[model samples]
Target: MSCHVLYGIAGSIAAYKAPEIVRQLKKSGYSVTCILTKSAEKFVSRFTLENVSEEKCYTDKEFWREQNIHIHLTRKSDILLMAPVTANTVSKCAHGIADNLLLNCFLSFKGPVIMAPAMHAEMFENVAIQDNISLLKDRGVYIAGPIEGELLSQDLGVGRMIEPETLVECLSVARFPALSLKNKKILISSGGTTESLDPVRVITNKSTGQLGKALSNMAHLYSADVTMISAGDVSSIGFKYQIEKTASGMHDALHHSIKSHDVLVMTAAISDFIPEYSEKKIRRKDNALSVSFKASSDILKSLSEQKKERVFIGCCLADEDTLIETAIQKCKEKNCDYIIANTASNFGNSKRDFTVVSKEKELDSYSGVSVQEMAYRILSLV
Candidate 1:
């Protein structure tokens, strides 16, 4: 079934991003109803929203219609998404002030509520706004960013709307907690580890930790206790991190925490080999140098001691011909519940196309899937 999303946009420079939010949701097969504050019209026009969302954009006048707009919307919406939520509206909603159709719908809706704040740096940093945000959070509203960056004030600070991709990811995570990972412990390792060869150089893969962060965010949305062991800085913020600079360190971190979590997702592109290192930086010299290399133990192979039935999901990079076979083999070898065989074509792309397999055989395959959707699928499998 398609999720019904009532998207509310407030008065902020970030309102310009509203259309893309709607578009992405629709692309993900969501039914969206847009609500706009009167002041929001100054930045984003109704015509634009209507075109993008393919639904009527409601305003304060909606309540005057024969139908009770708020009640109607409340009954239909599965999630109330307030994006680019200005500080003004944040204060209003926090105080139970239903001055507009959006707030009216907000109060009437009983489902999940997701608010992404966007405003001037000064306005966001104001004590009143911070308190209001806290109040909303206390009321069980999921709060996204207001990430720190260039604000509408032409100054850098903690007041920029999070990107549409992140907002979309957050919305998906918030909308469906039915597959609630409530009380389940998730230990995830993400990003690519770098092995130091010298002070000036190291070996690392192109892995950016995008999928790991997505999975963690989804797990968090479902109320799971998540601990991420990252190879370096992860893309998503707000997760507890255990940073490891080398493949050996990453192996140790996972080995230590593997027992505590119900699920383990190994997405880090760890170095297969590490070179013997010199304590001092290799100086530029006339003589050519050759460093001896040694194979590193595979992290997944060492999971034999884990108790049976612990869910393990692993990702492998390989060619199409060997993909499914490799995934199935690895699944059995590592005792993984499921495995994803991703081809080289999607190395750094926003969308991933891969085959999902179990130890015995191929279960399913997904193509052209967003990282957000990827997170959703993995959770469903779990």
Candidate 2:
């Protein structure tokens, strides 16, 4: 409520909606000031924005003012909120083309910045634009939706402005200075690791990697640099991804990533065994095929020596009766700072119950119908 927000508006049809966002943030007790680019003035009047923000709106004309408005605004604001960020603006920001007042401040501001992009579908989908978005994301920017809905052209795809209400909610998520994971790098391994029997066939579990994906998103929300290494669906919020095919491959991938991260979230359902792989298609020989197996190398066990200072979080799935004890043992075996275990039945289900243990002692248990609960639990430990 006591926060100062610098709201930047770019040239786009969605610029008309900027006033609503400023009004809402102001209502929430944020001291909102608006910065409108030259092109943005065509869509939204400066007088209107100033009326809603209850503060004077600045434009490119102020860029050369002797008062040094850009630097002052950059240092004064607690957060920078850019709404209706056009593709042109996005590309310029990404390439360090600070030709406008808003971008000038954006370059100098040392606070959190949230970008809500809006443009034509094709422009938004352009490879260059996506790459720029990726660049901003790597810099720890929180990007809200350019949700799919009715575009001003009456065509619908992915380039619509996120409603002001949703923008407000997302901005609140970025307001936590106390819980900020500003300088930490978090590595998460997720998804069901697949082992190959042949080029045409694979061995995999029912895990869909939703928990890992959720945790990655939550970690981003806390401003941590997130890297997801997985064999399944993963988000590239940060600048790293390691997709492995077999258990041994997954093991190698995790081990390669261990030393660079401050915290390791190992939720990957890595296969325990791998069948002897065939170079070619293993045609059914007389309808009787024999397969041999060997245990995959343990990823966590190999890292015990190096995990003394860094935080390691491990997850185990076990039979109901052995869940708690197994989780405790896993923490000791893996040198984990914390361990979570749940019944094997909860592996592929949407609802899950997890028993949390830390430092060889039982912590509390968490049960939820949504992955948000687990994400919160993991963040609390971090």
Candidate 3:
């Protein structure tokens, strides 16, 4: 089915760029409908937007009489986009202010919404905007960026709207989330599992969990249900990491919660060993401390043995020998259908050089792609 995207423009100096966004969406084979806030029209003329969109721009109190445009448009769109979303409009959206045609549609509609915020650095940094952004995220609203770069005015800082192409990439249905596992369910495990050594210390790995989260998000976009279980707090701040707890209690919680999911993509760098005797509180008297550790339960192997019908995918990152051999061995030992193998040094980096090893195929490689693309490719494979 062809995708239809509703573009909402708010008041901002960046409004002038809205037409280009519409044009790009159209070029990408999306049916585009543009909605203009009254404030936005002041910055970019309706004539320009209407001319580019080739569709009537709605922005009036008499919206219903003018062809019941709001409902009709809402029913037709697959996604809603708010570009150059100003601080004022974001606050209004956060607080459920349906004072305008654009806001009214946003409040009443049920569809994926993406926002690309633009404003002064100070206003964007305001607590209110931050709270609103968080609120929107909780509601499953996707945000492209207020990516940092030079601003329209002289001052250099963040809050500039992301370029149209980047926005298109996020919304693009044509080229992403590689083909193998599209429309398939994928579960991912990320970060290093912490084994409490003492109250203050834990045994953990250097894993940053970037690979797993990237894979999770990409699988999600490809119409797969994704569950991410991490041993550490992953946030997007550095590598789009989000803080997630990995305490023993939390692990149990996740284990109990998982149901009849089909695919389990295990990329998490789980600790194989834990302290033989962990104290509830800190052990203070330090005198050449020696702690013995026993191997923890093999989560992937156990799951593979228990769930025979599901597809189990594993990751093996090695530093010494040829990665393909290690990945194949790991795949066989773990009873996984596929293994994504790469160098340990490639972890937490922008570019990924990895190979896909499955029972049916010897090797297929992907590299020099964003962690996101790497994820998409992996998901496509199944």
Q: CA lDDT of 96 in candidate 1?
A: 93
Q: List the residue pairs that clash in candidate 2.
A: none
Model 1 misplacement above 4 A: 1-79, 83-100, 107-113, 117-165, 172-178, 235-237, 283-289
Per-residue lDDT tens digits for candidate 2, residues 1-382, read 3889999999998998898898888777789989999999999999999889889999988887747899988888999999989999889888889898998988999988889899888988999999998888777778775767789757987888877865765665554443557678998888898888888877888778877876776676666787888887543433356787567787777777877888998888888888888888989779798989898888888877778578888998888888888889888888898997877667667777888897658988877645656766777788
Quote the lDDT for 22 in model 3: 90
Residue 243 accuracy (lDDT) in model 1 = 88
Q: Give one digit per residue, the lDDT tens place, for model 1 in 113-136.
A: 988888777888899999998788
Query: What number of clashing residue pairs does each candidate have, in the order they appear?
Result: 0, 0, 17
* Candidate RMSDs in order: 5.9, 9.6, 11.4
Q: Could you say which candidate leads in TM-score? A: 1
TM-score of each: 0.69, 0.61, 0.56
Rank order by lDDT, top first? 1, 2, 3
lDDT of candidate 1 vs native?
0.82
> Which candidate tops lDDT?
1
Q: List candidate 2 segments past 4 Å from native.
A: 1-114, 117-178, 285-288
